[model samples]
Target: MNTPLRRLATITLVMFVALMGSATWVQFFQAESLNTDGRNVRTLYREHGNARGPIVAGGEAIATSVPVDDPFGYQRTYSQGDLYSAVTGFYSIANSRSQLELAENDQLTGRSDQLFFTRIRDLLTGKRPEGAAVETTILPAAQQAARNGLGAQHGAVVALEPATGRILALVSTPGFDPNVLAVHSTSEAAAQYRALDQADGNPLRPNTHQERYAPGSTFKLVTAAAALESGDYQADTPVPSPDQLTLPQTSATIGNFGGGSCGGEQVSLADALRTSCNTAFASLGMTLGEDVLREQSERFGFLDPDLAVPMPVVESVFPSDLDQAVLAQSAIGQRDVQASPLQMAMVASAIANGGRLMTPYLVETVRAADLTIVSQTDPEPYSDAVSSATASALTQMMVGVVDSGTGKAARIAGVQVAGKTGTAQTVEGQPPHAWFTAFAPADAPRVAVAVIVENGGNLGNEATGGAVAAPIARAVIEAVLAS
Candidate 1:
């Protein structure tokens, strides 16, 4: 080869080697991500070809892959449609798969690691087998009750079995119907899915566990825990002031919900929680200091990165370097402290279950088409996040809040209800959102609930959680308890 010819040949070889190396890296290393990407047509082809399993609740098919006389053979159909859209989510050839549908994709389709042994057993018996089904912990009655209670209201209600952490109902208003995107053809499904994905309402958020909200006074549960754990406050421990104390690091003054001073120039811990007194609790927060309060909050799993929920779950925030003023504000559940309904439910569950917060679960078990149990979850205790004594004391305090204080509307007839009510200030001028959390028959404590009603505009700023959100929470608890 001459000078020019040799140079061209060497250059060509180098370029060819580099191209091959790049192809190898992506085709092998990045293949899983690329193929699983919602836009991967090949993955859609595979999903449609297989007889994907059904997602059932209350003995009814909420989600299934229906066969269509098309080239790919089938499409995912949602029977409950919009009612359970947030839970089952949408598996569209047009849009991406998400929520429980995507998280449990392997299990729902009966190709999970646990299904291998069952498959072998079927082969040994010389019988062809269908994929498995996913039975969620949801109770239809409670789900309907929540839907009815929140009718025409733009908020969410979540109820869980406190002992087992099995979510009975997860409801978010203004949801979308999944049927519109369950197209048999890949291209059509993809197109339909993108429309919803691009829409402004953000219908995909299963608000109970996914979206973060100002926890409001429901967060007082955590503050109470911090108080007890610090050894500073007990059921009868007294707070020292009735006046709103000016925040140390800022110009803000923390006062009671209605700006009423805590009665009698001071109040006992029980009385403070019962009245939902902002001043008294602000003093408690300052006394506990950042270290004690933040430590207790973290122990409650507020900052967990890998939350146990299937879809995204937002972690509760508690600033580490909290100033005296910041501590006071956080104690009243404001500014940068955000949490989901699931988190509040967990807090209530922790108190109900003697300070042990079990990880919340939606799907209780996965079974074969023949009704064989493939997998299940025990009522496993996550952590000894609080002392048993502390839980008992907190339970009593919450019960007091409901019986005669702010959460009175949450009382269920014949049930010993324990609850906390909140009317959290959202903005300087806007009406605060109403929040209520409760668990009933306090002794056995079966169900726990957390509910939020946005704006409370019609009801006006005077809408405490008792008058607004508590009734809804009560209805859900009654429905579940009746069962």
Candidate 2:
């Protein structure tokens, strides 16, 4: 061949090799990601052809796949759609999956490595492929109580078994019905989703673990734990209780709720906490300094970016490198200190569980279609948030709050409830958010709960965590204990 002809032949061969390489990369190396992509229409159709597993709670299926007369062999359906929306989320043909539907998609679709043996058996026996059942830790009674307690309000409630870190109840309202989005019609599902997205409060957002809020006096639990752990304070230790505490180097000052005195010029730490004294905690926070407070906050699970109760939990935040003024505000869960209801519930759980903070988890077990267990979550410790002695002291102080202070609404008829109430300020002129966190039967605690009512619920500016949020917490505790 001539030199030009030889060069032309080499170029053609190079082009052919490039095409082959691209095909191999897409067909092999990138196959998994491409197949799992939410936008992949073919993958969605293929998945719908199989019988997806049921998402069970309290031994009943909350989410299940049923045979349909459409091209897609199965259709997803949710029981009590609005109540479980935050947990089950929706599996839609028009949009991506969410919550458990997204987090456990592999197991739910029978594609997880844990299900390999089951898949092989089904293939060999010529049986229809089926996904693994996902059993959640949700308690139906507690969940229903939380829903009824919240009652058409905008907020969230999280209840955890302190000893196990099993989420008993997780609720966010006003919630959207997953059924509306689960319809087989792509156009109908898309339209319904758009409406829910644009609705007030964005019903699609799960507030229990996905959203954050100022914790208000409820965060004083962290500050109090810091003080007790520092070896400088005790339940009976007298701390300054001035009506107004001026921040360092700034003219601005922090005052007690309703501008009232916290008993006297100096009050016991327990008394200050029982009264929810802002000035006292602000003074103590400045005294303890930012480092101690931040570390303590993190120990209680703030600033952890990767916490997942199966579904991803948006990390609670405690801002760093703050000056004295911001530190004072943050010390009170104001400023930039933000937390989810789940994080606050963990704080109460740690205190209830003798200061051992267990890692929170949602899914209890995953079982193959034939009823063989594929995976189970073991209870694990997340941190030692405080010493047992410190937790006891805090528990006693919290009980006092429920007995005589601002948290009286959380009182149970025959049970000793330990709790803290918070009224966190938000945008200027708007009502502050109401918050309450507590555990019941303090001596042998069964349930730890956190409740937040946004914009003071129906009371607006008139809402205090005690008046608005505490009762909700009380109802949840009652249900958990009764069950």
Candidate 3:
């Protein structure tokens, strides 16, 4: 053969090999990701055409897929739309999915690997595969109580069963109705989503875990835990309780919430905690130094940027590089310290569960269409935030808060409640945020709850955590106890 002809043949051979390799990459490696992308019209049509499973809570379907005559074949519906929107989230063609709808999309759409045997059986029998039902850990009554507790306010409530880390209730007020976003018409759904996304107070976002704010006095729980865990201080250890003290190196003067002495010039750590004394904690925090404080905070799940309850939880952060003044302010739950209601609930849960911090979880079980259990969530401990002895001491101090201190509004009849109240001042001129975190039956805690009322509810700047946020925490605690 001529040299030029042989060269031409070699060039053609190389071109053919390259074409085959490209085709193989698209057919194998990129297949799953491209197929699963929500923006893929074919994938959307396929998922919407099938009968998706219902998401159950308290033995009732909170989210279901109903038949539709359109090409989509089904439309998702949330029975208690706004109440469970933060949990079930919305399954929409336009805006896609979130929360459980996003996390369990495979199982809900009957595509999970766990359903392989079922799919095989269906294929052999020439029958259609059915989606699996996701049973959530939510308690309807507790959820309702949380909703009513934060009624008309812009805030969030998170309740967890300490022993199991099962999220019982998660409520974010100024909630949007998920049904609006689940409509069959793509245009209508997109428009509704845009409206909610643009609404005041950000109704579309889940504030309970997705947003963070200064925890106010609710964070005293962490500081107290740190003090007790240090082995250098006991609950009754005498600490400074002056009414006012200037933060070190800065002219900023920190005082008690109402400008009164905590107890006296010097009081026990327990007494300072009961009173939610800013000066006491600030002084302690400064002494403990930023490294110790940050370690304690991170142990309770702060600074964990990717923490999630099966859904993304915004990082609850404690300021990193801090001087004495900044540490003092952060100790009082001010300065750069910010936390989500979910993180606060975890703090309370860690104390309630004997210092073993359980990993927060939402879904309890996943069952096939035939009611056969396919997957279940096992309870896991996230960390040992404090020793059992420290937890006990902190619990006693919190009990005193409910019994005779600022958290009195959280008291329940015939039940011992351990709680802390916080009134966090925001930027100049804005109302302080109200906060309350608690666990019930002090000796045998069954529930740990955190409630935050932004802009101080109806009382404006005069609202204190005990006056505004504690009552809400009480209601939720009672609901869980009663159930």
Question: Which candidate wins on TM-score?
Answer: 2
The local distance difference test score of each candidate is 0.81, 0.95, 0.92
Model 2: per-residue lDDT, tens digit, 1-483?
599999999999999999999999999999999999999989999999999999999999999999999899999999999999899999999987999999999999999999988989999999999999999999999999999999999999999999999999999998988988888899999999999999998889999999999999999999999999999999999999899998889999999999999999999999999999999999899899999999999999999999999888999999989998999999899999999999999999999999999999999999998888999999999999999999999999999999999999999998999999999999899899999999988999999999999999999999999999999999999999999
lDDT of 2: 0.95
For candidate 1, give the lDDT of residue 483: 90
lDDT-best of 1 and 2: 2
Tell me the lDDT of model 3 at 274.
91
Q: How should the candidates be ordered by TM-score, best one leading?
A: 2, 3, 1
Better lDDT candidate (1, 3): 3
Worst 10 residues of 2 by lDDT: 176-185
Tens digits of per-residue lDDT for model 1, 348-446: 888888888888888877888778898887777767779999999999999999998888888877898999988777877878888899888799898
lDDT of 3 by residue, 183-241 (tens): 87889999998898889899878989999999988888888888888899998999987
Which RMSD values do the candidates have, in order?
A: 2.8, 0.8, 1.4
